[model samples]
Target chain A: MRLGMFFREALRSIRANAAISVAATVTALIAVFILGAFIPSFMYVRSAVSAQTSKVDVDVYISDTASVKQVNALRDKIGTLKTDGQVAEFTYVSKDDALRLMRERLRDPSVLDELPSNPLPAKFNIQPTDPANANAIVAAVKDDAALDPTEGIVYPQTTADRLLTAAKFVQWAGFALIGILLVAAVLLIGNTIRLSIFARRREVEVMRLVGATNWFIRWPFMIEGVICGLVGAVVAVAMLWGIKVGVVDAWASGADTALTKTGSAGGAIAFPLLTVVLVGAGALLGAVGSGITLRRFLRI
Target chain B: MARIDDDIHDAGSTPRAFTLVEVPLETVPADLAVVTPPASEKRRRGDVFRPGPGPMVQFQGVIKRYDGDVRGLDGVSVSIAAGEFVFLVGQSGSGKSTFIRLCIRELRATSGHVIIGGRDLGELKRSKVPYLRRAIGCVFQDFRLLPDRTASENVAYALQVTGHSRQEVNRRVPEILALVGLDGKGDRLPRELSGGEQQRVSIARALVNQPRLLIADEPTGNLDPDTSQGIMDLLTRINRTGTTVLVATHDRDTVDRMQQRVIALHKGRIVRDAEGGYNEDPGDTGEIA
Candidate 1:
């Protein structure tokens, strides 16, 4: 029953002090919106980088002079070198299969047809358990005597490194932005609560004289703060959902955009999870910000 | 009742269980017949009354010093028994406000102890201040009513904060408002009420909790002589119910007419303490009516 009264009081105060309430809510909305916008984009970049890195593998090309027995021996040797499950799996591609894959990938059959014969070599694709360990596995394979007849080993080192660096930068920048925005949101809410408390200072004094407990005086203001935060967060989430459906989905359907590709590959956090996070953050900020600001006024 | 008093004194080592009783209502003077008979009976049996051994308020060598060596109260000692109506009269800056503030624990004395209802203000913790304040009702010169709240809400707020049920608050608010003669004005905001009506609402708010002590600071400073008389009469009625009433005022005429115990202060010191009027001038009768 007391909680119900507190809620009624909070609602009434919010309605009565519209200016401060709106200022706090709008500030919270902008902060949460900025946070919501950055989080998914950051997640998308990180996931895309990880997906690309996972595709990194060493392709060992076999020379035409190499014997079938030698190739088989190399395969057995590579299988034996799988210590602690460092190498995940391996597959063998024949010359004809490689030529077929090239033709399919290039989408141009004329170039392949002009060749006198299939100059493509059979290759063994080695998958490492961790993309970070791919280079080490490649070195081990190259140093082995049985793989002496290999033509070359290819791994997209430079591209993977660049993508990982970019992902790291995005992660740092996202956290920094979120930290700054959270401080701004807290300050805005605190200032708004301070103004409301100042306006009702006489009432607070009366409450004190009446033997009201400190929590009794504080709970209503805290509830009001939470309402402001909840409203702001709800609006921010609605805007984010609208943008995702209207702008992002439309652009993705019309043209193959990076965001669309990331969305397909589960590059960002789930929508429901993001909603919970934003809402929870909003409530926490409001409760804590106002709770701390009310300390000075409650001294009366 | 004697056993309870004995237990309280023996339980002094365990402060949590110690309870102070107020003065009995039978001690009220016979001439103050304004106290309703039923109310006095209720107070006699009600949980609100707890008769104790000491005075309602005791100031022992109290001294208050502000910054730059300014004295608010200098070596002033006084005691007010329960159920007594006393007037605190002095010029501005003569420690009238300081005396009231000290009783409510709003400001600590620079030296000496202030005991109210057998509890020392100096020993009270910050967390326990609210409990201390709940035992005392306070009124101000400005009436301090919330501008947005109706008079009923202003009065109900006193009960609500002390954890009274909604039904009890609803029942008691109107009763107190009626006692203060604000029967139908409970719905009016502070701005709508006259200054006298607003002060009465404030008084009702203060009295709603049935506090043992009521301290009014310049309650009649803003009212005309007639309205001030009405407020004083209401206060006297409250006092007759066994609540110790203390009024700090600059009104000479009310002090002279009421003939209550008057304590005069000058430069933070008690210049006079007698049962008469504002000043202890020659040829002024000191007899109570």
Candidate 2:
């Protein structure tokens, strides 16, 4: 059949079954809407979580008796950890640099200037690639001979552990919610199409008796499904854009919300790409729902 | 009880074995046995079906069993030649519908063969069922027409679905609609037409392809007697054009008036097959035992 013929038939069917068609479209819209809205919010939360975790770092302090060669070896060990993805980066603060940093921090510069021969010890500030990896990084270097015996390494272990747990929860819960919603959407859309097809099953039977091939009969229905999907997706994307502009943008612009404190919520979500993905997903879901539901009816 | 005992004796083990009345070619009236020209020899507008040489439909001990072991058709065998008009007469549960369904390969026989136009329907691939149906026009009691389409579009749909070009569909649609006595009613939807007119539109759609066989399961079941007569007359006229017509009906008066070949089924078995009125003598045909 001609492409135009399929479209004409599909349009005619959609008009004839307007109520069910609308139901199917609305089903797709609701599904796509929820999924689209959740995606950006989840991304924002994940970004904020990572930002908080990025602060947990390992601090290695060296003893004054340690030789330059031992310090150099420790620096090389940190470089190896960086390559292994355990450490994000390491910066060395020599005794003189430490004394200068301390002098800058003290409001009374004369107090720091009274110290004789810079009594501060050198240390290496180590940032782990992941907050949960801070404990591992500290464990890897705490036994090294170049470090001080007493306060050799210091990391906010309790804070990193709690942040890691919270981050894991956020990631898993977000995925579970999206997954459950997706399955529910598929079933709802499929049921609506099933009812629609059931209403017109006699039409299909007559077509089969009149010598129309299965694909010939399937084309118009499939096209109708695809049209519903595309329309629903476009509507969902538009709604999501409205919410982004009206709700999210308004909230982010306000004074010092927790989201704004993280400074990663606004301007970070890709609205254009999200629109494309949501539309594509809507179309795919619509097509699959109707196509599979039509199988049992076509056997006649 | 006697029939059951006889069936067991004849079949040795199966209690439903039936004796089919085979209508010998010589027994058929000379005029009704007229040989139709091969489809390729006389190609005309909308005549796409090419029926191979031999009987148009043959059922060899075909048995159909529904769920719960209820026999729909049991050990039934019959053959219908091309270009003949036959009436299938039976009660509601006498397997008339099952026979028609088997002819279209809509139901498979349990252990027998249903061959159509020299092709075994049992072996016809599932994908090819539509092609098989294309060669056989079918009508029903309800006049199955698309409610949204006009009569002309409904007839055109049969050709359009098979990828016929616009020029072919346009030409054939009007001709077939006119042939079915719906010349000026092409633009009317099914709901706008009377019961008889709706059935005519359905017949138009069915015969638009000019199939080799036409099976009507109670084509006049919903119509008044006068309208039913008109529809039967139309079917007779179509049969005159060399399309084998098989109609299953409960209209005894029409069967008596037509005086066509009648096959009577009782309890899923053919009890009589003879060219006469509805109450023709069963012994005049094949042996029942």
Candidate 3:
């Protein structure tokens, strides 16, 4: 009977304050939709940043004290051992070839021409199995007696570290924005429910005078709040879905495909999923916020 | 101040000391008005303060002030017995409503105690207030029924608040509405019902809980004389059923015709509390005299 009474009252409040309930729902849906859409983008950006930071092209230089026959033998041996985890690829780089490649990259044509009789060393351009395996690859090479220790191996560690920090920043920023949005959700819900409850102060006072428990009075308002939040979430999700589809399919025209390999698939469904999350988030937030306000203002 | 303080000192020296009701503005003080039996003040040494047991509710040296601590019930002492129908009659600013407020735990007396059912209400714990409320029903002038709900819903609301089950609410609600002659009008809203019917609905809500005491603060304040008579008749019926009914009104005819106890408050003091004033004609009940 008590449960029925609460439900009946809750339904009455919702029906009575139709406009206010709609307003609350819309706010929640939009907030949740936005949060949902960004979550995918945030995750994608972090992963892309991670990939960039973790991959590198590496090269190991072999010295002249090592004879051609010995160096060549070592190269051939290391090339076959690539499947064993040390080397991703092993190929010989002749002094002349190295100079030529340097001229192409550096645009220093004069330096390449003045490479005194193949001054550039014969290098084994070795790509490690993984970027993280660079140091291990270097150590494995060092254990060999044939390699020169002076300029044994090199990988751009500093660039990788910077990229990692940038990825972390993107992830954290996404999370921070999500936190702010949730707070906004609660505030929106609180104001809406407060207005609805305020409209029927006499009704609430009468309830209190009758010895109604605090929650008995609060249940209907909280239920209405949750419904509002969910409705808003659904609408927001639809809007977000439209945005995602429109941008990728319609707006993506004349856009650089060379820029995005994954296309809208990168964050297409995330918006709809985001809407779902927003709805859930909105409902939870609305329920809690309404509870607090109702508890204070309504004596029961 | 000097004369009053001197009287207080002298009264304090006596054994039957009836001092002021002392408490905060929120806690309803128990005040017993020491009524002299016409010969006791001149004869007895200790019986000066004790008015002798007469009723359950008495205002003893009670005072009430609103803003700037102005007194509302000052040194008021009157005894109202259980099952007594008392009419609190006074003019505007006569502290009639203040007396009711004190009686129902709405406002506390500034000095003296306001006792109810042998409980010194000033000393009752705050959490137990709702429990105390369960024992007393309050009916207001505006017919404070929830407008959005139907008549039965409003009456059922009273029991539901006390966590009554479906069967109990269903059983008691109809019985109460029937008692107020609103038996079949349970599904109608307040606006749908007439003014008299609406007041009856309010009465139905008040009586649904079966409170030991019924306090109607101007129950028919908004009704015509004919309608007012109807409400009075309902009260008389309830009183006949053994519940003490304290009605606050400036209605002379209603008080006069009932042959009930009348307590008149002038400024904050009880100027009269007696069996008189009801034997007059049953005319002009709504006109403030």
Candidate 4:
């Protein structure tokens, strides 16, 4: 029953102070909208970069004359590296399997048939825990006794290095942008709430004189703030959903651009969950903003 | 001062009533005769000061010094028992407002003590000020009504903010409004009402809580003579019901005509305390009596 009174008071204040409420809501919307758009885009970029880095690996070849026991020993060493948290995993490809993979890649099987016998070397494709750690894994097993002398180990160092660098830059830039946007949103919304409370400070003083507790006076203003925040977030989420459907989806499918191709290959974004988080964040910001701004006025 | 003591004869044997009863000012047990005790007789720091019986308001050598060393109240000692209608007469800077503010605990005394209803305000916790204010109804000159709320809503607000049930609020709001002579006008907003009607609404709001003390700071400052008279009469009627009413005003004609106990202040010090008009001695200098 008391909650009903608080809601009624809050609704009345909002209606009476419609301009301030709108200002606060718009401020929240701008902040939440920017955040909603940035989150999925950031996730999509990170996933695409991760997909690229996953292709990095060190290939260790076995000599044609190496004994089965020698190959087993190499596999055991790779297993030890995995257990030590250096190697992610390793796949052993026999010469026959390598030859069959090449035939599948060639335009004509006749080209491979002309070889008379398989010349492809059997190798263990060892994935590293981090793409940046490829060089360390390569150096660790490059001179192993069981490996072929001519093709002992091979890894695409330049590609892995470039991908890792770009990923690091993107991650840092994303964090900085998000931090700036959040601070801006909080300040703008808090200022709006402060102005609204300031305008009604006389009413608050009268309430205090008439025996209203600090919380009694605060609950209505807080409810008004939460309403403003929720409205802003709902509108921002709708706009984000529109952008996802009308802009993001169409741009990704309209061309074979690097961003669109990778985004599509990485799978769909979790927009429903992201919207919930954005909405929750907006409401929390509103509540905290009003709660803090009211402290100075409640000193009576 | 001796004349005030002679005028206020002992009527302490009368029983106190919790609700409003229309008794005349003469029957109010004129307890203003209890003069401030000397320094040696005053309660010490560790002692609790509940005046002889129970004065609704007491200020013992209360000194309120603001920043930059200006004194809002300087060594003002006064005691007002329950159910006394007293006029705090003073010019703009005479500290009448400061006294009222101190009574409500809006400002603490820089030194000495302000006791209300046997409670020493200096020792009252900050969190407990609301409850202290709740027992002391306040009416201002501006009729501080929320612009958006109707007369009834404005009055109900007092009860509502204190967590009273809606039914109790519904029952008490109209009763207080009718008592303050705002009966059928409860639906009107402050803008729709006259200056007099607005003050009536303010009074209703202040009295709805049924506080033991009612402090009106220039309640009639904004009203014309006739309207001010009506407001003062309503206050007097409220006081007759056993609530202590302290009106801080410089309204000469009403103060003279009412002939209530007048505590006149000048330069933050009381220069006159008697049962008389606004200026019993107009030529008296602004010095502590």
Whose lDDT is greatest here?
4
Q: Is the docking of candidate 2 incorrect, acceptable, medium or high quality?
A: medium
Can you list each candidate's DockQ? 0.57, 0.57, 0.28, 0.59
Instruction: Output the number of the TM-score-best candidate.
Output: 1
Q: Residue by residue across B160-210, what tens digits does model 1's lDDT show?
A: 776677887777788778878888899999999999999999998888766
Query: Which 10-residue span in candidate 4 chain B carries the lowest summed lDDT?
Result: B42-51
Please identify model 2 stretches exceeding 4 Å from their true place. Answer: A61-123, A129-150, A156-177, A253-269, B1-49, B280-289
Ranking by DockQ: 4, 1, 2, 3
On the 0 to 100 scale, the lDDT of residue A108 in model 1 is: 72
Q: What digit string (tens of lDDT, one per residue) describes model 2 on residues B246-275?
A: 999978889999999999987789999999
| Interface RMSD list for the candidates | 1.4, 1.2, 2.5, 0.9
- Candidate 2, Cα interface RMSD: 1.2
> What lDDT is obtained when candidate 1 is compared to the true structure?
0.79
Model 4 regions more than 4 Å off: A59-125, A129-136, A144-179, A253-257, A260-269, B1-18, B21-53, B280-289
Worst 10 residues of 1 chain B by lDDT: B11-20
After superposition, candidate 3 runs with Cα above 4 Å error:
A56-158, A241-276, B1-79, B91-129, B266-271, B278-289
lDDT (Cα, tens digit) per residue for candidate 4, span B8-98: 2232322233332344456333331111122233221211212235788899999998898788999999989888999999878789999
- What does candidate 1's lDDT look like per residue over A41-101, in tens digits? 8777778667766777888887777788888877886686565587888888889999999
